[model samples]
Target chain A: MSNVLANILGASPVMPLEKHIDVACRCAEQLAPLFAAANRGDWGAAEKAAADIEALEHEADDLKKEIRLHLPKSLFMPVPRQDLLELLLVQDRIANRARDIAGLVMIRRIQMPASIADDFLDFVDRVIDAAKQARKSVRELDELFTAGFRGAEVDLVAGMIEELDRIETDTDARQFELGKALFEIEATLNPVDAVFLHRVIELTGDVADMAERVGRRLELLLSD
Target chain B: MEAQIVYIGLAAAFGLFMAWGIGANDVANAMATSVGSKALTIKQAILVAAVFEFLGAVLAGGAVTSTIRKGIVDADLLSGSPELLVYGMLASLLAAGTWLLIASHRGWPVSTTHSIVGAIVGFAAVGIGMEAVKWDQVGTIVASWVVSPLTAGFIAFLLYQSVLWLVLQHEDPLARAKRWVPVYIFFAAFTITLVTILKGLKHVGLEISVRDSYLLAVAIATGIAAVGAYFIRQIEPDPKAEKEQHFHTVERVFGVLMVITACSMAFAHGSNDVANAIGPLAAVVSVAHTGAVSAQSALPLWVLMLGGMGIVIGLASFGRHVIATVGRKITQLTPSRGFAAELAAATTIVIASGTGLPVSTTHTLVGAVLGVGLARGIEAIDLRVVARVFVSWVVTIPAGAILAILFFFVFKSVLP
Candidate 1:
């Protein structure tokens, strides 16, 4: 059974789901280059990061489309069809939000203020943490399914999801503080840069928000 | 003697034509999943179908052939004029074959079983009067039209659920699936062999009592299960693949199971569908040779073989169109899902064959697939296709009946 080759085109929901998680992480990875370019005012590097993020997001979108098109109108599955679709929607949105942030970085062209740079990076790090936790929970899904969504493993994944929510919650408070700091420094900074930077901050936060949603989706899936 | 030879030859030809239609259209319903799932290539599917359909028919075809010949029409009434019965039988075969050809040309998914049964009833009602038709048994056969697919569906639903509960739902699915593979194969073998032995082998003249058949079935099942375990034991999980493609390893296990069950499905199809072609041919041959008709006639091996040959030829000649249609429809068959549908269809068909019911393999397969859909996989199934299949079933009986009635008059008038 193990050595046997599956049809390269075999129909399973696992492939798209796995790809969605992978691309979400890849989108998150682009944040480093995106932020580096923004800080250095290297528009060239920032443009590349933004384009790559958009491309990865589209690729994930293609995978999602393939899954939807190939998913039969009727099938005998262990999970509800709607549940699987909703899970994929959140997973794809994670990448889409990351792409949006990359787009914002390119559009705003705002250099990070030297005073708030460290705090902003810390805030981005927490958002990525929440995103990673979401991806981690998605990965644990295959394991949970094999475990019949029961026993210690189910509880273990639920714990991980709870941790993701907590991380997202913590990031929210930090983001609010950062927003206040940007307003406080508005007189010293270019007013346009301050406004766009706030937009960039919110978009960056969305990636984590989408990831938390995915975690919650999985938690709901296994409660049955 | 020359006249008798000519009559026999003509009857045999019409029989072959009907068998070919069954092989062309009906056998594809069973083999489609194997090809669609990539468990067997098209060539491999043809080879498996040819060999197993032959084996199934030669081994177990007698049961349904008996039903086809005597169960619908009263041979006792025809005993006074055996030649008329012979002509009537030949007409039914030709009419059924004609209807099949027409249906195929138009791309209609009609059942071979319905056409043949309708042909028999039509000939009996018009040629020998309505009293010659066994109305009570006719009711039972009609009821089975609805019952067969539902039974197949119920079985498929249970099998798919069991696979989920026993294997896919486990904490370590690949490992758990490995443990369950032999168990699944063991049941496939057990049920296939049990039905074949208990009901099918009587056609081959190897009549085992119930106890002996059960014992033989168990032994055969165990041997096949042991072999399945050997091939399965050789597989080692690919850690890299497991990481990249979750459940790819588990799906591969089901691939092997799909192959095993595909063989059983071909065998089941052969046992039941072979009778559709040869039952009337045998009745015609016996009357031509002995110049007498009896309620019970032995199904000669050569007659059964002729039906087998006709099916193989039909598959070789006309199977492509139906196979293509099936391949297109069967889009997303992971190995376990395909296995669930195949196992259920085969089990139901074989059981029906043993009971001397000429159930439609296509109908039962549709039912089995719907069962898989009902279990939470409905997004992958098209209800429109299922609805179309039901409509085709309704059309098949009357179409064949009208054609058979017309052919009966033509044969009788020309012969006299």
Candidate 2:
């Protein structure tokens, strides 16, 4: 009956935001299997993983759009709507970067160098860990809102963001090492293959970078 | 005598219609919070609302009914022509009931209290004379319309903030919730019980001194809280659900608190809103029975009973669908937050009912919800709906007044 009390409550974005990050992290997760398949020189398995990544990336995009559409200008929330919109953008990028990495590998048919394969897969796994950690951090959003973005909940999320930062730093270090290893064998590899491999490493590292930015966006909400 | 019977019959029918409308629409807002929070199922919410709303109307609805019956209009001015008073009240009831039906159909957020008060003020000042209205009492009623919501908001803010600090923010929130929820339960029960004792019991012909009222309230509240604690203790944490949502078990504990608040909310709604349904009927009944405007006569218990029964009938017939609709839409209000809003609004309304002030229960509730939003407890609140509520608040008075004026002239010529 057009109840005023019911209308006064705008749809809550907390659960949806949590769900979006979960999808983004799962998309980033697909990179691990995609890279592993490529490292084993199994083109068919790698393509399947790439397709999975593509599907999840599309899902994340849809979720992001849905969250934005619900978050109209009239909504009064505890955190700034701008900050949440920014956070959603950064979270979506994890899936976007995962898709980009898989797209590049599939287009170039880049075979892993024998010397760098083991280290490269490790780097990929660590980057995915960063995305997972970012999910863990953003998962605290509902609790943070419940606590009014204060007290022990803030500290708990702060601790999570700190761990997220550490994982990102670890991804950075691994990316540096993978770059150095790729350079030593660049001459033996085709010149174009060598260049694209470095590009892929950089793109892979951007996953963690986007994940780190999720933490930063959440931090902005925390500070406010 | 035949004309008096006609007036009484018309007034009863109109009052029952008004009461039924309130039961159908207004009761939903009072019960939706509990249903939305999952603290009470729809069936349970209805049953609870039925019982408590009836009790509230019968036991605590007198003061506000008296205010609406005689406080708003200056009865002395109409002593010469008591039939005019009957015509005006009959018109006010019809006007308010008609306005509510129109507003409900249009899906506008209008208050029954505002409409009735507006209707009474309209007929008295216009149909009779400008000085025939009790402007000071009207002023107080208008002031309470503003003050009740703000007061409820402030209380809700504080209550939710305390919940955050005491329970949700703790290192072990489940343990904290278990330990502290009963105390909150005690407060909720205490405030409602105390207010009802102080203000409502006298209407039932039972008066307790202030000292004994406090002691009796404390005792009753303690028993309710003890029963609440036992239920809270029985809630076992679902480890799997807890992994998915950390507050799962804690909210279950707050579920017990929400149920208590829900009852208070029903009681509060019945106490104040029954007056809107029955106030005019009481006026017409008195005038028709005595054939004189006598301020000294006591209010008959049957009028309150008739109002209570009308509301229950309304709830049975139409409130079911409205409650389900509202409950589905407000899923964001978990028990912890819903209790704060309900408790604050219930306390404010019961207090207003005690003081004989006719405040809008829906507006007070909107205020409480905004208070929760202010404390950062709610995830999202639409300021647009809130703005619309204010607009309707300002517009309802004139809409009801114009309608009442039309009905007043119609009744003057048609009625013997």
Candidate 3:
């Protein structure tokens, strides 16, 4: 029902074969707002998006169970049912990860730290851009399935990956600087909080990496 | 008849030894990628290789036994002289077996074919003078050492470059890339089927015309490619992630290619090299039973089965070590690179076999590894180890021949 819930459901069919497109549309809508909140550094809004994602995941699980129950004897399917299931699981993982990042912001309960917030903001923007590209590609899956288009997609993914790597490198440099500053102001800050912040930055980078992996897989599938 | 039985026994034992050596060394060729990718554990790899190899050898092994027994050597010279024929076969088997065991223990990958040729020469020299051995056939076999690996390496290098250009270098959007994947799959399938049916199943009496076979192979390949493409297209793309997922996909595709390559290698190897073990057995059978040499002797099904079984046992018991040496120690084999090397190696051997050239799979694979290493840069290759392997190749024939001669002479003296 909510945008967050819809994004979490992703573009996959919901069950009994008829609801898949509807669920997929819901998933896309839900994901857009989460990205927006992440961009604006609205921690409370991000937490709501995360809650929507959690609810969507529950819905997907329920859908899967229902599909299994109704189609218990149905052997023939469009594709290998297991493969479809795996695809759904992987898509759901993307939503889950996005939600987890949002939840982390809420739990930290601090205004975006002034020191590295801008850098984090920039990295998030790049990630959103990549996700947007992926969504567009998925929408045009039929046209892009040809060799000419698939070849272009592979190149695009490669470029995005390179940019992601570059941003990660920059983030690492910033983290190093922040670490030194934290040590300098050790009397004012808890060392444990610094460590936690460091972990959060690393996890954020990992989410970007997971997104790239999905891009590469899509490229291989479409191009081959 | 008594003497012929003894020779057959000796031949059977030799065949078993050859099988052991193959199981010990060649199984790695098939399972190495799976093991390296951690897709299959070492123990799992060995078990799978052993079972599939044995099944492949026994169920599909045809004409290979007869080719090995009668195709290479002149049986006329040993005609009417049962004693000489028996002695020659026994001597050849022992010599070849000894060479293989030594190579295995030392972690060398000397060809079973090369060792057998040397043993045959040694026995032929003693049985009917040096003139009885077909020097031209021997020359062809020797020439294959240089030809097989170089050809395989070159082809593999090209294939890898093409894959890189098409998949890694292309700048299409994800949807477009997904669309093209079917074409690549089609090509891969076509090539694999064409090679397998024509080369792998050649010995089996699959009475289809070559043209028809090619057509059928292409159609099947296309179907497989289309199916693969459809599934791949359904997944979403996110390019700003780590590249491990891409690597993982490459690994899976490579694994499939390697399996097909291994199957073809096994089939071709069986058809061609069955002679190393059973050639002597056939020679002994003719000498003791018919008291005359004959080139047309058909190896009984039982004898061929024995040879096949021996190979299975050898692979199960002692093949793991040799596989490890080749798979890991030869060069670091990433899935894609290893697949390229194997495809090159299989293609080279198949062409050589078709043209009746007895090329060494060992040479071809090593050459492919060298080719890949050079592509990466020679500095990355361990030249000293490669040099040692090359030197061993030069010496295998002579060493095997001399051992055969010495062993035969001793057996002759002791028996009388």
**Model 3 residue A144 distance off true place after TM-score fit, in angstroms:** 26
Ten contiguous residues minimizing lDDT sum, candidate 3 chain B: B374-383
Listed models, DockQ each: 0.17, 0.73, 0.04
Q: Could you give the candidate ranking by lDDT, starting with the highest?
A: 2, 1, 3
Label model 2 with its docking quality class: medium
**Cα lDDT for residue B51, model 1?**
94
Root-mean-square deviation per candidate = 4.7, 1.4, 15.3
Q: Name the regions of candidate 3 deviating beyond 4 angstroms.
A: A1-224, B39-68, B172-203, B219-241, B268-275, B286-289, B320-331, B374-379
Instruction: Provide the lowest-lDDT 10-residue window in model 1 chain B.
Output: B376-385
Cand. 1 Cα-lDDT: 0.79
Q: Compared with the true structure, what per-residue lDDT tens digits does model 1 show for residues A27-128? A: 787887778777878888888988888888899998899889866754435576788889999999888888877766776676779878888888888888
Chain A TM-scores, one per candidate? 0.91, 0.98, 0.56
What residue runs in model 1 are displaced by over 4 Å at the alpha carbon?
A: A1-31, A55-92, A95-99, A118-167, A173-177, A180-184, B1-6, B41-43, B104-107, B243-246, B316-331, B377-379, B414-416
Q: Write the per-residue lDDT of candidate 1 for residues B1-416, one digit (tens) a residue.
A: 77668779888999988888787777777787788777788888889999999988877677788888788888788878887787788888888888878886776767889999998998899888999999998888889889988998898888877877777665566777778888888899889888888776766667889898888878888888788778777777778766422466887777778888989999999988888888888888887888788755577778988898988997888775566557655655557777887899889888888888898887887787778766543224544445667788999998989899898899888874
Question: Each model's number of backbone clashes?
Answer: 18, 0, 49
* Candidate 2 off by > 4 Å: B243-245
Measured by TM-score, the strongest candidate is 2
